[model samples]
Target: MFKGNFIQNLPKIYGTYTGGFLAFIILMAIAENAGVSKETIGILFVAFTVCIYAIIGYLSRTVQVDAYYVAGRQVPTVFNGMATAADWMSGASFVAMAGGIYFGGYTYMAFLIGWTGGYVLVSSLLAPYLRKFGCYTVPDFIGTRYGGNLARFCAVVVLALASFTYVTAQINATGTIASRALQIPFELGVWVGLVSILLCSMLGGMRAVTWTQVAQYIVLIIAYLIPVFWISSSGNYGIFPHLMLGDEVAKLGELEATFGLKENSKEAMAAMTFADGSPVKGLKYIVNSHAGVPDGAMAAWKFISLVICMMVGTASLPHILMRYFTTPSVKAARKSVAWSLFFIALLYTSAPMLATVSKLSLMDPSLATGIIGKSIAEVQSIDWYQAWNAQKWMHIQDFDNDGKLALNEFFMRGDIVVLATPEIAGLPYVISGLVAAGGMAAAMSTADGLILAIANALSHDIYFKIIDPKADVRKRLLVARALLVVIGAAGAFVASMKLTSILGAVAWAFDFAMSGLFFPLVLGVWWKRATRQGAIAGMIAGLGSGTIYLYMVKFAENANENIILGIDHLRFGIIGASVCFVVMVVVSLMTPEPDKATQDMIDEVRVPSGKTVLGKQH
Candidate 1:
């Protein structure tokens, strides 16, 4: 599908992508400076992003099997890197990360460390080998390497489970960002997002998703960086927020103290009035409120557990790993991972910094003084309060009879940190719109990858491989497209349920992936002795144990009192992954070794450069 100079053309493509983004920014800035209404500009910003990505999807549309499955296995290293970054970033990294950092504080660094460091596993242990294996999907690698219909079916089940969970979160993020940005109902927003995802993914599969993600990465990175840069410059931190976040952190602590914002204290827990004038308890931002561990060592243990889960989960996620399969070669896969980390690190390092700055700005004495002594009516009249209040993301009530806004009177959801940062920092509404559009890009990009992963697993692994082995390219492509719509709709419906925060849902999906797929996938490539029986058993044990434990602790009887060894449900992936690893090792030792043919296949994949079978076209 592609010949020489594919890599050389990537820089020009990126330049064009950057130029398009800049043009959008300039257009939005012009409208903003011309005094266009913020609401109008925000809607236009979101609409423009969706429409442009849809255009990219249309242009990249392909009916060929190679293009649909792995973008013809010809994506260049740098563009592949950008696409992987976009796929990896997701709504969690773009929208919810700063929010997580804002509420979770120091402990939230786990997400940063886990997600970024996971690429190390990808480069060193996963990507190169998988690319060399020359498979269309993660399950393909498993089925081909291990042999047997049972192995292929089991891999499909795990892939579907993990990808479904992951796609739901990404869709949820899409709805969250769209609802807030477009001023639409969340239910409607979710459907809107579903349409956008289908537009991109249903057209060209991996090919469309790849190009769209590259475009999305540009939008998201710029959207994330601009606000951080603005906030830093505004706070006199110069352009480098990471280097000077210490002062802001200290200032935030001081401001919290001055406002009498003690953790779990009555002052911080003062009851507040809802928009309808009904009274309810105020929200708590205390770190220990949901920590489930009071002691430092226990908290550290929980944090480390989550970090391990995220790291392994990132490496385990099918959509993320699927990106490597699109690259031209094993060496390109390795190089792409390095570039992915470089692109991702730009946002990863800045998230905590933005979180710190946002907290300081929110808790600043000046804003506190302006609101502290104000009536409910007066607080409602405030711009930031009114804007966010309209979305019900923020609520304030004068708890005391003194008719003054106290620290307890102010309540905002964690999600507001990123959404409201531009407004909070006095940036123009255009910047806010751009940020919102950026969030959409992040959500849509990840959703594209996830939907493609699930669709491929179903259409390729299950339907074409087992249900209809005689199916041709046309039939296979249609099956994938049809399944994509079904899966996309299901994701949107689940997302509309609003089960949890963006980060929480994403973490759970990560946990599921790590639990079910991590051990089998990793060992399948690295361990020649890893048998089919072992892979199947390991997946079942890991998924079953993790699911049961999470249910017991999160939704079962006496769930609140059911923490295992002081471990939270979010950190349950470590338990699952551990069980899978042990089970795989034990089962492999007990079972017959893999055949000589399988060993030869493994040896070939171990190499970094080679032509290998991909499909009939190859």
Candidate 2:
């Protein structure tokens, strides 16, 4: 009865929590206006929000295997949608997405389109069916569907590779936010973020992550929206900036022209130098450059290929698919996907507005005009410049030897754009603090889901299912918790190494997932004839081919000259997925079909009205 009431009243409960959080923000704003130090406000914002999530994690802790694995399969639809949205946003979406748009212009909209469109694939093709199949993990589904340790083990490998890569990006995002908010080194910030992430997920697992993500979604969306709203209302763009993106973008392009920031302009292509007289590598800033593709002839192909990878990858990602397993039923799972899309759209639609307005804020002559012609000493003395400069996020060197700064003389890391926007716009320090907390929440929420996905795959699929099928719940839970710590620490270490930009790493993860798992998972559900042998062969072929291509393009000299159909590293998934489909189809045709029982189970998954096929296992 208590559980029933708790679930029934979740909407009201979260509403009250949202209201209280707003009140807290208001109080903090008041403190800031009353002369509270910026550092203190930053610390307070991060500390307060993290403590709240930690407390939720603590309260939601469960020792039961079912709850730990799948939130006892009782999560409400609306809250689950919110949790899924929080999990989906990640550090890449919150921190680096706008920056990607600001730098790459219309080309980066592929990400927004692909990611959002992926959820439609989820709703129609995967989510409800997976819920009906009643799996705790994606690997669990693969293991059960194909009926072999080898197939399951292969799935776990793919899950680990993709989830680990994705988690590192999330940790990188956390490190970026922490370095700015806490004034710590980026390396130390990675561990700091890891600790908060572990606190939220180490105990109750899925249940803890679910509730905490709801809280995070609130913070992240509010944090994301406030500054955009503030900046938009302050400008001629008005309060609803998303509707005015065209005007703002046109204005931004004008500023780029005024500053000679066009991609083809000599000023943009000029060499630059650091403050220490060392030559800075390549053009760091280009107005409206198409990302990854070189020739105009290949732009459409590259764009379409990228969208395909992201869309399929979205469906293939194990951490995301696992969200549907927490829902109460297949019907609820489908509904949850709809709600997830709605929640996600709120942020997705606003990202471009944030990007356009943020760029305008820094460029508009009526607004941050001094930057283009300002003397080095003068610009260095500005508060936002000094703060970001201290962290090495922004740099300026008058490469032309003029005392005043040229547009090309300035360089800023794209990862810091969202985090530094409030400060750049000269908003209250409290808003910066709020954005930091929001960024942390975004990173931590995704990290929690991703780490859980990896750890669960190892503990449940590899350890318990294959090595010790007789293991008790306690032992299984113990193994999972321990793996969580190890995997998270490993991710933090990789993140500290700074392998790639946050968005770059995320794209790689998506491509990797799509390459290896998309065809197998989709085929497993939709094509009953997909034999275990075919699935295994497809996984190896797809992942192996994609990985080799990625290595060549990224590491080998002259590799770009031979790229197949202009498929760069970001679009390797297209080739891999295509190869997997062909290989899987051919192999399955050559192999014997699945036994009748397996075919029936596949049929059972498609129906929406029955109890979960594997529900009794728990």
Candidate 3:
């Protein structure tokens, strides 16, 4: 009865929590107006939010294996949907997505379309079936379905590599937010963020991560929407920014022409100069073309290829698939996907508005923006410029030996767009702190799910399934907690090295998952003839080909020359996935059919209303 009431009251419970959170924000706004220091507000936002997540984790901590691994498979549909959306909206989505749209223009909409379309594929192809399978991890399904330790081991390898790469991007985003909010070194900020992430997932695992992520989604969506609405309401773009996006884009194009910021234009690519008249080394600022593509000849191919990779990769991601396993029923899993898409759409639809307004804040010719065409010293005197410059995230220089700033002379990292938009638009300091908190929530929420996915794969699939099948619940939970700390620390270390931009790293991770896991997982469910040997061969072939292509494009000299048939680093997954599908089909056809029991298992998974196939056996 208690459980039933709690499940029934979920809407009211989360509704009240949302109201309280908004009230807290109002109180902070009051404090800000009352002469509170910006530093104090920033610190308070981060400290307060992290404490709340930690407390949720402590309350949700469990000794039972089922609770730790699958949240006891009793999560209601709506809350599970919220958790999945928070898990999906990583730092890349919250912090860098708008930046992508700002710089790359409509060409970057591939991410938006591809990611959202991926959910449609999830609901149809993967989510319901996976939930009915009753597995704890992706590897468990591969191992069980294919009837071998080797197939499962391969799945675990892919899950860890892809997840670790993705998690580093999340940690990097956290570091970016923490460094700005707390005024600390990026290296130190990575560790600080890691500690907070650990507190949210280490004890309670998926159980803790689910509830904490729900809270995070609330904070993040509110944080994301407020600034856009604030900017719109201030008479910049009118009351509905989304409706005004077309007009704003037209305005932006005119401004680009006035500033000579066209794609690949000579003026846009001119060398920059420091205030001392020395050349700024290795810098170029290219604005999006009117069509939002760098090269018109290959735009369609690149766009389609990217969309396919993102969609396939979305279906194959192990952490996302794990979310379905926590739903109460297969019906709930399907509903959860619908809800996840709705929640994700809220932020995604607003991103273009934020991107346009942010660009306008700097480039609007009618405004009193003294920075453009102004002397270097004069631009340096701007408060927002000085603040971002001190953080080393923005740079300005004169390339023409002119005493003024050019539109092309200014440069900022794309990762900072969402975080810096509040200040760039002349919003209050409290809004900036709110944006910082939102960015932290986005990064930390995804990090918790990702780190748990990796640790769970290792502890449950590798340590228990393969190494010690007799391991008790307590020991398994202990291993999972310890692995979470180690894997998280490694992610922080890699993040500190700053291998690439947050979006770039995330794309690479998606490609890796697509290359290695997509065909194997998909065919395993849809085709009963898929043998262990075929699955293993396909995983190796696809991942191996994708990795080699990525290495050549990223590390080889004259990397541009290595791009074959216009497939760049981001689109390599198309080739990889195609190769995997063909290889798996051919190999499966050549091998003997699976035994009767295995075929029956596949038949059972197709039916939606049966008891979980492996729920009690293990």
Candidate 4:
């Protein structure tokens, strides 16, 4: 089945992805209807999905340097796009994105717009030209462009920092899925996920990662669509929930109005709290807040700042930029970006709908009407609430000392919304298992891409280029595989700490990538006067400033003072990026222009069609 040209083999791979999943669903339905427990079914679903990815990874393994680094540069556009989309939508995109929207409301539009728009920037400014330039890693582009080892090293440091931060979050997400699916402790689940991540990535590098991501994309798209459609159908929102969910959003607004749940009010703020005697304090209700809707200049400034950060960050991510290197040619790279955006939009557009449908379901009159007047015990009798509470995934307190329940009295974690949707809608256990599999697919696919990005930067850029230029391909491959293990272990360790919010970690990583690399990368390709000195200076300033800003926000007592122009520290990447752009332009003007060779190299990539030079550098 794998013994043909990529075009010829494409259908078979797609068939395997779709057909294998259908078979799993059929078998799971039989087992579930035949009296299998939910836990057993969930375990089977996750195991089955992982097994499929593992098989793909194992079969696609390659020791050849080209295959190891960039999948032989033979991936067709459509398949490459699918792989890129899968890589782009990580664990945060899968599990926490909708939850973020459900909790933060209109403010969260930054994620949707920034992420999607970032791809437009990719196709326009980065993807095709990078393919034409023909580099193994993002740092290779930087080092070669600037003609210095220092540029390369700085690029590697920034890339590793951002990618490692992002990968830890993906690993953390894997643990979250595993713990919920297997009903195991979170720490044990982290190890299970770490082992599975290694199994998928260790053998093949980019070759394994590319094909496995395609399969993962298939699983995740199906997994995401199923529950939303099921809930939509059951709720009479029609079969196409993505198009029909506005009505549900309207219904949610009505319910909020009826319950008098004003998000910005002191009453609403007062309602938020952790479980009684819960070590965590200052946790307020607004589990779903409609607070501080973006209304004026401050809102616009904050929104635009976050959007810019996300857009630049998305375009700057090394793992994502590496995807274009796998495509067959420059034209293929451009075409692949279009397909990538289309595939990603499938989920991005649905996310808001999912958030709305979930909120509507939670506030459905039938399930929630009597709860407002009932005792905590009586509310516990409700199956959905009881099931979620029993798992300790959610906690509801009788805040306000009222014996009866109110909208603010019921506080559940946002993480539980998508995972518990199957039960909330009274769907069968099979669907629940399927959702777990989907979440795992999302996490594993992104983890595979991120780990490869880090491993390649170490082995190819740092080791092969600088440490041991005389090293053979075999030695280089060995180093890469070793780094994969080391990096994966390190990321898993940080993930086990679970210190930051999942989405917060991802956001910070994006901020770091954009701030440090965005100007140096974009200017290197498009601006001829950009010099090594300028690139180096800009990167240090940007990275140093962004890192300092993030540290202050995370650890300093006067963190609030760090907010500039009323923008939060999380959006400070916009400031960092702006600083870098200015520094690069000014420093380049003060320094000598790039050599003629460098200018010609930049011109070579500008051609729409060119040979993609192979090996470590163009």
Candidate 3 lDDT tens digits, 1-618? 234666687778788888988888888899999999999999988888889999988988998888899998989998998899999999989988888888778788889999999999899988898888999999999999998889999999989988998999999989878887888998999999999999999889999999899999999999999999998777457788888667777887877777887344454445444445555433324367433456675777788888988988898898899999999999999999999999999999999888887787677756665356567788788888887666556778556678777776787777667887787777888898888899999999999999999999999999999999998888888998999999999999999998886777898888989999988888888988898888988988888888889888878999999998778888778877778788888888999989999999999999998788896436
Which parts of model 2 are misplaced by more than 4 Å?
A: 1-4, 262-271, 276-283, 289-296, 368-370, 373-381, 397-406
List TM-scores for all candidates, in order. Answer: 0.93, 0.94, 0.95, 0.95
The CA lDDT of each predicted structure is: 0.82, 0.86, 0.85, 0.83
TM-score (C-alpha, index-matched) for candidate 1: 0.93
In candidate 2, which residue pairs clash? Answer: none
Residue-wise lDDT of candidate 1 within 114-138, one digit each (tens)? 9998999988989988888888889
Using lDDT as the measure, what is the rank order of every candidate, best first? 2, 3, 4, 1
Span of ten consecutive residues with least summed lDDT in model 1: 284-293
Q: Which digits, one per residue and each the tens of the lDDT, describe model 2 over residues 291-389?
A: 233468578777788899899999999999999999988889999999999999999988888878777766665765337666778888888888666
Cα displacement (angstroms), candidate 3, residue 174, comes to 1.4
Compute the lDDT for candidate 3.
0.85
Superior candidate under TM-score, 2 versus 3 = 3
lDDT of 4 by residue, 101-170 (tens): 8777778777899999998899999998888878989999999899889999999999999999899999
Q: How far in Å is the alpha carbon of 69 misplaced in model 4?
A: 0.6
